[model samples]
Target: MFRNGYKMKPIIATLAGLMLIVALACAGESATPTSKPTNTPAPVATATSAPAATVPAGATATEVPVPAEGPELTSMETYMQSSGYMPEWGEPKTGGIFKWRVSRNNSNFSPNMSGTTHGLFNMPRYGSLIRFDPWVGFTSIIPDLAKSWAWNDDMTTLTFQLYEGVKFQNIPEVPESYNGGKVRGDEFTCEDVGPSAERHVRPPKWETTLKKGQRSLWHLTGVTCPDGPLGYTAEVHFEVPLGKTMSALAQGLMVMLDKDWLEWYNTEHPAGMTKGTNEAYHLGMGTGPYIPGEFKSDIVGEHRRNPDYHRDGLPLADGIDVVILKDFTTAFTALATGQIHVMGRGSWSMTPAQVAQAQRDFPDRITVHPNAHLFGYGVGFNVGRAPYDNPKVRQAVQLAMDRDEWLLLRDAGELPGGMKMLALVSGTPWSYSVEELEQMRGIRDKLTPGGQEDVAEANALLDEVFGEGNRELEISCMAAGVEYVEDCLLFADMMKKNLGIKVVMESVEPAVGTDRSKTGAYEMNSGAVAASTDFGDPDDYLLPKISTRYNANSSAVLRNLEALKVNEPELMLWLEDTIDKQSRELDFVKRHAMVRELENKIYYDLALYIPFGQRMAFPGTGPAVKGYRLFDLSLYSNWSIWERVWLDE
Candidate 1:
């Protein structure tokens, strides 16, 4: 059973070091493992006696098989243990806060509505029923709020055994605590889980402002907490026999909401504030290891350690202080100046050129995690608008794009190595392969090295659409991030050079970028988005992204699809039935075939989006930063492991 979850953009910037571009190559069923290795020899520190093994940047250490004389390896657990990855660290001593910098200002901590920034901020506070194990390249599942879970024979129903004593945050200062009856925190129960599950599908009208809530709740029919052998047992019934039910419930979509608190909040607050309410942002409680302490819009969001955490020896740090910056250069400067302890993956945090510069400047402090991210940059067209509404023009733009050139310019003329992705979601069985992608139009003969420009094809398409040489395009992008700004400029130049289009690149503030995207205010927009394959399934990518009604990005072609579904009932029915069957299909081989078929239709046949290279998350930390690692390459799930991190200095 596998399912990929709806993915948003990778952290908007690279926080500390150089952004190393690592190519993804499939090995069996698992996604490529992301490794962060230092460039120089192991630093001599008195913290431990043994020196840590250093795998070169952009390389995975081959797992050597046990000798014939030794016992055969059984599972990944044994392999990882023997591979020296499970090194014993000295006893953890917790005290200091880990200062981290995020590129974008977090709007709010609302689970369903928030983007990457808000998601990361909420991670230390929230808990899910099931979670992707980061140590295993997210190939395995681990318990979170739910202690144990199982699916019935037909896979239509999932039963969860919750941890009986877990409690929500008890921050008395928050307004939601004034819900009269209890001045203290409430116990996390199936009552909370059932209402949260129901709320996932039946979001309030205000939820329309939240980008990805109801759209992700597909297949889930109802959640019940009936009397069972074990108390606090919850059964989640699905409309279809979903193979990736566990994976689907592992992301921000499945965070258990405090139903009582929400009801009280709605009663007290007006609809205006309740739509994107600050009360829900700050007052929301969870069963995790931290509670949100302070929030200064667009500047900082801080969290204090949860004193009444369920886990033993949790939240090694005193607190986490996240500084919100607009761009990566500032973040990089802060990391260098010792203002921040770690700089994570962000849209603008680390550019390829900056990475090269960082290696030259701070070789000892920098480390690169290659092929760790699941999202990438793409050129989105508003199909509802003119000129771009034409498929030929879209194809022309895709064909004219010199990906190889962009790679060179983006990475300072160096190929840092990355695989071409046919679909938005890579690192999974359903992701389109090179040979398969090569067979598609616009991509057939447009590769690197000796590939010629497709100016003729592009011009012909434009000529047919808007006569000869009348092609013009306006692009919308954030002005803060260097990578995004440069990409817009590069694409604009390419459009003019190849298609004879007059390109207009409009740079807006971070908030304005979101507003523009929602309004479909540009002919094209460019940026990288991060998505995760929580269960190695195709539904994650197709459902939230391709469906116009599912995503808040206001995808031009996707929005058109919603209109098409209304106008063309037969096509909608066929699509709905095909996608549902694909989701329920238990056979991996058959499901993969169906996934590839749909991807071909979406990418090649429709050409709604022009997929750029897949994203790579480079997590860089200071010398004294200990136990800081990216377990799951997700916005919310990665920060969940922050509790395990501690500061050495």
Candidate 2:
């Protein structure tokens, strides 16, 4: 699970010195007014204590006790009992019904959607204000539905508190969906946590989830709570300093909705709600532990549990269906004929040689569960087109192919000459060592085709960047899987047998390769599985693919920094002042030596993307499932953990 040694627990090694409390630097902007209101406590929901208190005037807070039926253990069952993945097949048994599939078809159940296939249909119907310690990494952050929080001092202001019996999710076909007809199961207040964290920083449904230069809630400005319903308390306010306000509220679309059923569905669907065409916001209504039932879209969805599931005894299944196959060899042949008990090894799963031939065709009724794949696999380059913006044609396509033949076409020939990755930190915490990524450079060594699969230095740099045989290009396997058609037919047969080039191939459809890699249409694609910005830091894995505010370089991996802000405006202002000073460095050995000095100048002096291979996550399960355990953290690693699973019989 943690792939060999890499330790750090104490719930995320105490959040890098407990989030360096705050040193302040406008991490990409929005919290203006530096100081005016020193203290304004007039909005109470039950404040008047002192087992240690202090607020907005030098922060303290602390109260927390309430353990009547919750917390006997949970911070994901104490990170599965300190990562030994819990008392194996014991405890956690309530009911069963946990089938699974989903390799596509989820455009709603909005926590402001942004794929993980819409977090397996809205993380079993929403609930957040922190989560992910599901087996530590993603720098931990627990406390969902905020039962305790406080920061102030220099952390702009944080606050939280609420958990007083968290409710919401009664839905009877939206019985006049709140604010008026009120049938969305109330009482989850502090006014629904400051408009659900200001709906991920406002604007007509946040321009459908912050795409244009995504700053993810550009430093959230306001959100104070307290007014009637007697104090659940929220507070919030940020201007971006505490490590980009704790990795922008530890994102998974930063959930927590139901503010009167989202202001009565944005006032009766006023030209909003698109994904899954608003079946009452895709059967949404959270306070999670499951609720939405029988939805359709890519066909078949359901969920039930939540008999007021504010943790007590818990959701040990009794509902969680999901179907939507869309091929991965027909969802690994419906999770190998047991008709699905769990499949999600996401990025549309399967292919570790179909999870090692479904663990040898279900020996002891399967149960793979390998994690460490937020995402990675690369080779992109459309770099403002034409001979891939020539750097000896991206160093003769990384010395004419050979990431161990893309790990033997992703493990089909089974561990063909053992895997090897060039970068995209294997299983992060800045993974290195395969003898330190085979002595770096363009990984496993190669600079301008210096040699690492040299193919005569890649056909003398494709015959001095296209002269003799006019080395062709185009390689767009964007969708359809089987490891993107065996890495586009073995990277077009190793560029026509080591750089006589002429390779073509095109497959399209992951929404047309995310809009033909953002309009610089294809010249070479099949990159970006680079997932994991769900907070774990290495600037959440290299600042959103080399940030320039996420233009993400017109797509097939890294290029446009506004065309180097106009041909090297001092290297685009020192790559935007050192990725905004290493994303506001909250000192983890100085942000790991400023992210290994900007990942060795973006993987060996701006070679601009080519890593290839690493993103595994198996998660199989079926020996009467039991309290299934595989939450290698990012967005609690899929299949919405069927509310802590069940069925030991």
Candidate 3:
């Protein structure tokens, strides 16, 4: 792997510009508004009108077009300047089917209750109040559904002015009985924010189902529409300071659900229906650029462009045809053919070797764009189980890990060192620099003496714990996807060879694996295979992930995590409280030091969670997909950029 001289992407500021100062200042005196509504449409493709997307010779555009009033959407122009657009992409042309892929099916259409396959399905139809600027660094917070926002002198209080006349999709799916005879296509307003926020953090069935919503918006203490239901002003109060609040808002993670729709849903399914199994589960009503259409689990999903969408000159393609391909080899084959225009996401979608091979073989057809990756994977042990209950056994597993081999396996047998190095934005207080990480004990080349020394020490620890030649463990290898099995097998082999222990494996479905983790029924496995977040904020990644409790796309990887809730209540509560102290710490220098120390002590010291390291991702797309920018600083943040992408050919 020779350097073609590709530089690593710049580190995104953890707090995102003078936000730390602004938040602290608010404690003393009132602060000014951060952004205001303005007329600023994007320059790219404003001159050209998108022609009707070409369909089959006889097949016409399925939906009727709702012509724009003037030239473009008034609401759309106000925030376009915040996002970056490429000059080389030239004039945008519209009206073509944007074919894509997702590795698996979404559990449901609701972002609140659905399983996390957000990029492909849920997000295209819904939006958040604020968002990170598309095609730029993650530092800037831009308006989405909101026109502008301000922070009061009190750190907890915030206010928002929303875009007026924003209307939900006007589909005939909603019946008059559902919302007191009001059509579902009515205007979206500030009053809707209250109910949407309530469902997000405090859903009705607290213990039974739908917890991902709570994880996404845990900071907010209250959200309200000061005026009646149709008012455009929203008042919000969060328990934390600026860092935690902005991270939750800027990622488009909270897709504002329709208030009337929620009332209807509660009336119909009192106990909350099982995730997406029923016929009514597929329905969607949103203010975003697309409308949900046909879907078949683990097969395909269709999103038709919303003709009445408020965003002007957006969603250049007529629709997106999403095909689910679970296997990487199969996905590559589809990419080589004309089956799909691009891979589903840039992060962890393909290896560097695959991208290079595609360039050499299909340069004329495929164009791969570079992206920064923040996601990593590794083994998570259930500490409530036997030998794993002993801290020595957990420490031995991480010490014996051949980290370089894990990277090599992920990189398609080639070591792309110095890319992610088990950390995001290395050299900062959050993690070590690339140079420093390369020489460390666990991360350095295993053939080196230092690496071998770690393995020897690991063996000694295991012997002391299990009384020499009497140690064995069975890992429940989660069958969530093919990669999960591969990572689990590699880890089992490493532990057996390095520490000389007997390892056995059992395969279980994703649903079964989640249950096993919750009840501490499994010894160890790849539970946190894609541990990731939307931004560079330390609190955003640290709190929901390793610090407190993890239960979304990536399961918890810490020892005693599940057991701590019931068995060691006080210890867990004290440790969680201590970890969150960094969030409230205002001083930049002090907070940086606090973040590093907490990470070392809370995450690495106990060896409860082992990281699989990071990677630089390349999203493979067709040359026809124009105006698409390389804005992947965060693993899941850039999916919203699809709004600006248009087709040329």
Candidate ranking (TM-score, best to worst): 3, 1, 2
Prediction 1 TM-score vs. true:
0.74
Candidate 3, 159: how far from true, in Å? Answer: 0.7
Q: What lDDT does model 2 reach?
A: 0.55
**Residue ranges of candidate 1 with Cα displaced over 4 Å:** 1-93, 111-114, 174-183, 207-211, 228-230, 269-282, 296-300, 325-330, 370-375, 384-390, 412-419, 433-485, 492-537, 548-559, 562-577, 631-633
lDDT of each: 0.56, 0.55, 0.59
TM-score, every prediction:
0.74, 0.34, 0.75
Worst 10 residues of 1 by lDDT: 1-10
Which of the numbered candidates is closest to the native, going by highest TM-score? 3
- Output the better candidate (1/3) by TM-score: 3
Across 116-178, the per-residue lDDT of candidate 3 in tens digits comes to 354566678777787765665454556677766776655566787777777877756654446
The residue-by-residue lDDT of candidate 2 on 1-649, one tens digit each, is: 1111101001123323322331111111222212232233111111111111111111112322221233355434543453435565676567767777777666555565645566666677777775543433443445567655667656667777766767787867655455564537776877677666666566454346544214555667877775543377787787765354554464445677767776776676632445564374444677788887766666567777878767655577778777676756555545544556776645555555655454333444456665545556665665676656656777667656666556555542122212355444544444454666665544553333444446676577677766666765555444433346556667777677766565666776667767777776666666544334444445555555666664433343344545435544664466557878866655444555666676665654455566665655565666677655543334333333456667776
Candidate number that wins on TM-score, 1 or 2? 1
What range of 10 consecutive residues in model 3 has the weakest lDDT sum? 2-11
Task: After the best TM-score superposition of candidate 1, give how far the Cα of residue 629 lies from its true spot, in angstroms.
Answer: 3.0
